[model samples]
Target: MSFTLKPRNGLPYAIATRLPRFPFALILLPMLLAGCEAELNLAAVSQETSHASLRTDHYQALASNEAVSVLVGNDGVVLVSPDQGLTWQRQQLPGKPGLIDVDACPDGSFIALGFDNRLWHSADQGQSWNVHALPTEEQMLTATCAPGGAWWAAGGLTTLLGSQDQGASWDTTSLDEDAMLTTLQFLDADQAVVTGEFGLVFNSTDAGQSWQASGNLPDEFYPHTSHFVSLDEGWVGGLNGFIYHTVDGGQSWQRQDTPSTAPIFNFSANRDGLFAIGDHSSVLHLSGERWQTVPTPNAPVYLRAASSGDDHRLTVAGGRGLLLNLDTRPALAAQAQ
Candidate 1:
């Protein structure tokens, strides 16, 4: 038999079925109330506390500088590892927000983007964070710290956010077109590119002071992730299992074939070279004029973020707390020899 139990405060009603005992409502009333109360009180707890150690946390983003490596993920948790991926200390932001992406700034700091239009900054190598609010209500997709000490973030509806003073204040810019800017990356101090829906490609040469639209990506290709090695050379991965290379600074692109059909989600570079990660444990390494597939221990889980440490190793993070370190020092040594 099934029955409806309406919660207090007009929260909503939950139905229970297949009861074998008498006084079911009476027995479950307090338990339901307690659960509701606990759920309500969960948000009251501050997320600034640090975890005892790193667990299998579902990390969404990873970034690294010369000194530290940082990983951010769901439940507002940030993990910092100073010794590459050897050990980590976990910290959290208040309210347990979901951090989608993180980028290493030029000043040895990191900037992470929250799903709730928030920016989290950690100057002390992801040990602590200062949260800053963006000026828009649109969902932020990516955050980047340029080489010139400028911070930039982009999101839906061509929204571009910038701050020159280390995020003390922010300036908002929206383009004339109606498109979601998915990725904003700076190849140098002043050269950057932004790609988004409708094959949109915008370039900035003056530290984002001005932007110019470049050639459209073919076949309405929507970029899932991008990596630019220089001002005129870059790669963009898409949902259709295709990777496009551009030589003329986004003016045109040529598609590169891959072994996997899963959606490519992220890209990073280390001493081994450029790497891309995506669904179905898809990991690609740029080796000698071709994109080579790299085997992963975990399969079928979407890998979203990757970063390279000062040790020249690449660290990748993904769903279900999946973390993997790709060490190519041996290969580098062999090649050197």
Candidate 2:
């Protein structure tokens, strides 16, 4: 399948072609009351001096924001807030490297996927973790929990795994050859979708027991990645800034006009709309049927993640702990009026 380009903003155009290799603290205070009478005494005392040894700092400290409440990074685990892009804390995961994907479970727990094919569960809001080893080292690419108790994961070189007991044990499913699954979404307990490289898109109706090719994406767009917020609404971002949106199930797709041809690393949407971030410090906003470029105060920051919540708020993170918060309320409200 090929996507025909149409300009939405009359800006300079670039064509995408061909595949290429790619916490809180507490304080205490005391109060004193005066009586009718008081007594005082004076005395002289000598003070003693003692020597103590201090240890040197071993780890480099990094600053982060609150907008990112949960993040899985190559270095470690991080959590942030949505209101302000300030104040961040990091948690260390023992014996784990190359942290890839994180998902906030429905019951307030968190699940993390690592490069070594292990899954970690945190029930105390990411303060501590318990690791569960996978049967294979497939390098998990994406993970999502359904509204029910079921959990699903897709990863390395064409492998799909599902677990009804929440990662304690997994059952593998077959996928098309050369299909490196990048993203997975569960609309309900019995319906889901998965997307990956070389225009591979699959849909399952039986709780992931089986899958078939739902549609053919553009082969020219390599390293294809997609995300679905709900069963009926979803977006896919890939090479050369290619983006495809589906309002119905995977029956049809439409190309979304973008400003940059640089590879779009991530895309996210909420009630406010859609946001895409990528190379060259690029960020694009989707308003109804149009795409607009948003200016960034800081340049040369490689955006790795984008998330949107209610009240027209959006947050982005990348490049040396860079955080950006944007409010699209005025822009969106104006367009609506």
Candidate 3:
């Protein structure tokens, strides 16, 4: 099924782009009141049946930089490491606001954007945080920092904000005022791209000083979200497992067939290929034009934050502080050789 963004009272809602062809099933459960902990009945469902491969005991979550890697999630904050998901810590915000995304700045700082248009900054590498009032209460869905030390975030109502002096100050730009932004990538100081609700795609060449819409990516492709892996290569994933690739910046995009229908949350790539992670603790790899499902020893864990370093190491963080390291040296070396 495909979905599009519809604005309701200035907030974005996911609406079906087309009706389902098969019989649709709707399950409604009692809504939990605020401040209630949700409990799932795992006894009724076997481990094999659950798409998530839970390895909660084998991972260690770091509370700070040395031992812990920080990630933003539906919960407040999460720290992850490879030492068996061993240690976990939570930062109590002023309110119980669930964080949607976290970006660690180059200066060992962190910024978290979340529901209600909230923004928090931590200079001590997630040790302590201070909340900054945003221009609006619209959810800031995605954020990224450029190598040049600028930060940009996008979310509800098609709003985009950029900061030149880190998170201390921000300048709101009039980019995509009509579309909801779901993902953001800053390729460099003067170039970046954002994708979100509707078939919306925007690009900026002047460091987000202005933006132009690259409307309605091909109809065969879904527009649930989009992301860039490098300055020249990018991929967008959508509902019904649709994936699209771009080679010449965002001038053109081509559809890619993937194996799973799971909603991809984030994507990262190196010279070797592309990697996408999402629901059911699934990971998808794309080499050249071929896509494959890789078997991981860790099970039922969400792969959330992913960052590729110059050393060909792809670091991923997810469910219960699960950290994954996929070595790209062999594949990359073979490609180069």
Candidate 4:
């Protein structure tokens, strides 16, 4: 069964663009060598199953930086990939269903949020975790932390929690209207956004201290996952092939046409395009405003979490321990589903 973001509320990936390539001989030389090696060994990239270190339920979230990538699933399963997704070493957690959204913090650490307004911090990646109390009964479906542990979380019943003292104490807030806020992300230390069902979206430009209803989506679209390539360009996906693109930092949004009616579970983008995966092993590509459905392994897999990394590696995780790695491949074609 899908781990519902709320008791019933729905929600939101780690990467959405080619990160600024690192400079310096130590960094640049290794990456260039890796890229060359990957190109020289050109073979059709195939999906490899990564059974989590811990036996758990379905994989739910994926996040990445250049040095590390992490995936989390139900039953408190956490997998850490230091060299992209080539090999994932599982990390033990404290308890079951302990996290929903696991975010790669700016400080090289990680933070995980889950039901009962729970939060966990891991200094050495996900090898270990530590809990901090959140003063709310509602589940914190999605959350993120700025460097030094300034954090924000959003979830069911329009709940919002902020921590300035490294989660030592939480300050609560709420929307006037009732909507299940599913995703909370910070673009920088000063700006962030939260999104939910019925097109509900809130923005905070001043470090998430206060929020203003940015705008609701048309047709009451329910956005499941969102990513920002920059403050200006971004993407969101949801039920029934729904996808939205924003060029003006989400001040406005335009729907991207799609053929697959499968519910869009997650989105991750790079300089070339956005990789959107969802139900029925859906893998759709978006370049500019046009979307092209890419053929995926035919199976019963219901893809959920996705992240794009350096060297054209796109890692996706979903139902039944499904983990597909789309390494550097052909140019995506603009074709129908």
- Cα lDDT tens digits, model 2, 1-337, are 2223332111111122422322000000111111111121111111111111011101111111222355555444445343333334455577534455676666667777765677777777667788877776655666766657666678756788778887777898768566568778777778888877676778878878888787656553443456676666678876556788887765677888766665566776757667777654456677665555555543444556666655565566644445555665544444344
How many Å off is the CA of 334 in candidate 3? 14
Question: All candidates' TM-scores?
Answer: 0.80, 0.73, 0.70, 0.80
lDDT of 4 by residue, 1-337 (tens): 1131222111121111221110000111111000111112224346555555322246777887657888876666778888777788876566565456777877677877755557888777667788887788765668877644677788767888888776788888888655668677787777777887677877877877788887667777767778775556777887667788888766789989775767676787765567888776667777557666565555455677788865677888776666767763453522320
Best by lDDT: 1
Candidate 1: regions farther than 4 A off = 1-56, 310-312, 329-337
Model 4: residues with Cα > 4 Å off, grouped in runs:
1-43, 49-56, 147-149, 230-233, 248-252, 331-337
Rank the models by TM-score, top first.
Answer: 4, 1, 2, 3
Any idea what lDDT model 1 has?
A: 0.70
- In candidate 3, what are the lDDT values of residues 1-337, reduced to their tens digit? 4445443222233444442210010001111111101122122211221222233321111122333456454434444333322233444456644555676566667777755567777776566778866775555666766657776788767888888876678888756355557777777777788776655677878878888775456663435446675645678875545688888765687878666665555676656567776544555677667455544433444445665544455565655445555565543333333
**Native-structure RMSD, model 2:** 17.5
TM-score: which is higher, 2 or 4? 4
lDDT of each: 0.70, 0.56, 0.55, 0.66
Off by over 4 Å in 2: 1-68, 80-86, 229-233, 247-252, 330-337
Model 3 residue 62 CA deviation (Å) reads 12
Model 1 TM-score (2 dp): 0.80
C-alpha-based local distance difference test score of model 4:
0.66
- RMSD per model, one decimal: 13.4, 17.5, 9.6, 10.7
Q: Compute the lDDT of residue 144 as modeled in candidate 2.
A: 69
